[model samples]
Target: MPKITELRGLFKPFTKPLHRQWKYVWQEKGKFNEPKLTLPKALNGRQLNIIDPLHDPDPNALPDESTPWTSPTRHPMFEYLVPPLPREQHPLFHHDQPVFLFDSKTKLHAGVDQACLLTKAIPFYELPQSIKQNLDKISIPNQDDLIQSYIRQSIAYDATKEHLPRKSTPLKQHRSFRIEYGIPRSRQMSILFENILHLCESLGGRYPDLFKRHLYRNTPFYTTYERYGEPIHLRNKNSYVLTSHTPLSPIVKRLNKLEISSGEKNDEKLSTHDPDGHYLMKGNDYQFLNMYPVYPTIDLQPEELYQDGDELGWRQRKTNEYVHTTFYVSNDELIHESTTDERLARMVMFAFGSALVQARQQYPNGNLIKPVTVQSVFLLDELFHFVVFQLNTLNYNETNDNRYNYVWIDKDNYMYDNRPSMVMHNPVYGTERNLQRYVLEKLKYNPDVFQKFLALYLQGIQGKKE
Candidate 1:
């Protein structure tokens, strides 16, 4: 070799070291030795007793000579409370079956009964034959045209100086005409319009004139432009657009807030790199800015309402001021195992939990003046579970207090077990009929609740005018 250093330099330029590719390989095949864990049984085999002895009397506990009495000062709505179904009457109660009540057939019927009663005011009937014959002629675009014509009437009225104007053309001829109309640009509005069109089609199949009348008189549409504001596109940042067709004031107000934020924030960049982007500062950064004065407001914390214990398995913040509903759907295992009660309880938690979150969003200021109603529905394949809860107090912060009450009707097993193919053809009209019957039954037992719901339902359907 010329020199060791020279040889090394030559080898470094041409030679490559052989390296082995390594991968994680078990010396012995891995085994999943850990046992699969089963879900813990609800209440650890303890009996579930939801009855309040102080409020609800036990017929069995009465002495032989004791006479039954009713409260004179009982609230008007107290009569509407559904009495607990007997164990013998419960569908899931069998000597061999697990003692659970929630997802049982009885509970499902109770939920459905309550839901049906809650919105009993909504009309659901088969359309007349004359409308059905001409259904093929109706189209979404045509409906849009009709709605546009109705909107033009408002525009035309606004343009006139009143005294010299001729009688406005009758907008009722248009099948899509509504007392209140809004621009249909958003995905939600589009979906709503689609559903309206479907409803029109369904009703048109039977009574075209009635369908037209309902669309024009009963349904309300929110537009991007109205007499109260400019076209949504040209409106300034502070302008609020009415987006919902529902008459529920609270829901409408919430929708307005959404529209305002959407309009103002649409063009604003969210990234810190943008010149006009806003950032949340903390500690010293926030202190240095010395922002606008903050006012004191009630902070409604929904999370504080939840309690977990062995007694009832789970508890949630409930207010007697609002109606609360629970729904449950059992899985195959639960259904096979006859664990309806546990299923029902789980469903109630889910349904109520979701409603609670929505309520917080809808009433962010925490000044809900009207009673809040909660309807919970649980579906297990073909089985339907429903419950209605009324919250009498908004003070959900008091976790220890039993401030809410509920009614359930789960004895009847209303099945919507139509196959997907059959649904496309027939579309399960049985549920509507069943709901109607439930409403009729409630009307007989408690017409006041039905009337109260009707007023609220009508108010929601006929949304407030500007």
Candidate 2:
């Protein structure tokens, strides 16, 4: 008993404060649990006022004549000040990164609005009639209007599938990841050339002359050797094996040709994988409509934690919820020396953005809802900045033979140095080095500016930044 008393004495100070806190908590909880009397029923159809209305002067009354159109700035209570903006500076800060603002009164930066306006400069139906007609002729009625339809008809499709639905292109649906040779070796190059010519003629007959001119004249022949810096033999081979030492030009070229062929014909054969050396083997046809495309597997909602005597005091996340779907594309589609993974990632982003726009329009209350744009890029370097650099990097000098040197050249005359030669040769080596350094440095550090540049490119003439 004497030892117990000593221990109690030692704990008295801590116990006193803790007891007080418990009492306070209980008092609050007691009131919460107790029932309050309901207000007396209104008598004689009159509303009851709990407050003295005369003293309050009807608190909801509008401001009097002294108020100004805009509220005057009040002096800060704390001894701190906001930095003033420069006279020439725009209102936005770090415009490229995503930002969240909860204030209802605040508006989106004018530049964002301008960006949206730019997309409208080009209409959905502005494509050439040949490409357009081929789409209608080959693709399902719904997808005929898409850019993918034209690409499919021009590049991937064959003559047989005229009325088929877009049951997933080989680009998206090939189950086994194996490389397959298309057409016999004797007529491989010949077939590609003929296909290109045929597509051009078909496009020319159905589309406007302006479009035909671009398609036939500007578009390169459907040879893998002419696109990526790989040999013609590398086409339809597993990229991992070939790209280990070979440049990507040939593989990229071949896949591009295949894509165009499929697009033009809308044939199911375009999506087939090689089975027993038969590249065009008929495979299990899985319908996109039948497939239940699932959203990303993530629990977007935050877990709730309950305290002893309180409702949630705060939420951890404002909007972490998102939906994502995975679609496959042929690694073959993205072959070639010029085909950086970064560029491919950018392509994926663009496709998703376009799809998001369509989805927003289709959903209920979409106009009023501002959805967050979230995407994962497939290629490592194909961020917005990398995409811009690539677009600007295209050689505009069509007359220069070496300009297309980045493409794969024929190996038939390997002894003759038949490979593509460097276009930027210099009599003085120092000048060439300096120029390369300047361009390389610019791309490395200041890529955000280039991203802005490409964003502007996506805009039409009416889309010039104000």
Which candidate number maximizes TM-score? 1
Error of 1 at 385 (Å): 1.9
TM-scores, all candidates, are: 0.24, 0.18
User: How accurate locally, in lDDT, is each candidate?
Assistant: 0.29, 0.24
Measured by lDDT, the strongest candidate is 1
lDDT of 1 by residue, 46-126 (tens): 654433443556766555566655456546577555454466666434444221111122222233223222212111122
Worst lDDT 10-window in candidate 1: 231-240
Angstrom error at residue 399, model 2: 54
**How much lDDT does candidate 1 score?**
0.29
Question: Residue 59 error for model 1, in Å?
Answer: 89
